[model samples]
Target: MPDTTRARIQQEAARLFVKSGYHGVSMREVAEAVGVTKPALYHHYADKEALFLAMLEGTLAGLSRLVQAANSQVGIRLQLDTLVYELLASAPEQRVGLQLASELRHVSPERRAAFEQEYRRVWVGGLSRLFEDAAARGELRGDLPPAMLARAFLAITYPLVTGAPTSDPQGTARALLAVFLDGATPRQGAA
Candidate 1:
């Protein structure tokens, strides 16, 4: 079907873009990777920029939905667990997003700015709200600003979702959350 071909083109383009940076990969390469002709690819997306932007948008939208779902959960632990698991479950796509994100400098300034703003609004803003609620309930460690806490959480989890070598995503997510919530030092209790 046409829809299936379009989706395949998107997926292949994302993988190629991640593997060979945006500037390095050609539209022909993407078409070949997708087993489509250049004209067919153009029919799906006007240009490489259009295709790349579409890929980025899809990745961000998926992540936003995941974070929103996690946010609906009651407890901080459950929220973090669900967020991490869902993110890692889509690690391949997330890596493509991460790759494109790092290469945003190559995109037009206006487009880059818009993408950055939406990304922050979705990921950072969502996390900040969650952290704020947790802090209010004494669920967080210290009095750090919710925005800062959100950024820290993102930094901690970035590599995990991107390309970090992790044999066990679920276990890694749990350990990372524990270290995030409890800090490096153990609590005053039986070992």
Candidate 2:
């Protein structure tokens, strides 16, 4: 199959899944959304569960690669800022990703643990390593464990990307980073 057709199906499915819960949407709806026949959708994905799993995995794997790439560059603050901004910009994908976390029960029990592990490995695991690296370099606050700090950082930023509205993504990123790094107080020598 061609890349565009497959990509369109995935994109449309992600949209539908995000808008409607896992069980709410059907393969027929996905096919109609993608302007393809039901059989064509099946050619791309065995079933709705398979399609959802693929979307979730793709999102996590993409995030892992993104963070790893960002970590290689200098300036941890800039890295975090860039990451937050990018995540907010990709609202659809982020929504789909978060929705998958809540709706994983729809996944088969046999595959559930493996899928969750994959999600952790790509998303949490990658970010945890980045935080660990920052801690080793004395770039992160030493009060909290690097793992805890990473989780906190994600918790703080997750809402911003998942569903929060932002007129200014950069400003929002700056505020979030400041809060995550420095708490709510104004830094010394600031107005």
TM-score of each: 0.89, 0.88
Question: Mind giving the per-residue lDDT tens digits that candidate 2 earns over 7-112?
Answer: 8988888788878889999999999999999998898899988888888888887787678766767777877887777777776677777777688898999778
Candidate 1 lDDT, tens digit per residue, 59-94? 789888988889889888889888988888788778
Stretches off by above 4 angstroms in model 2 are: 186-191
Task: Give the C-alpha miss distance for residue 60 in model 2, angstroms.
Answer: 1.0
Q: Candidate 2: global Cα-lDDT?
A: 0.81
Worst 10 residues of 1 by lDDT: 134-143
What's the distance in Å from true for residue 191, model 2?
A: 6.8
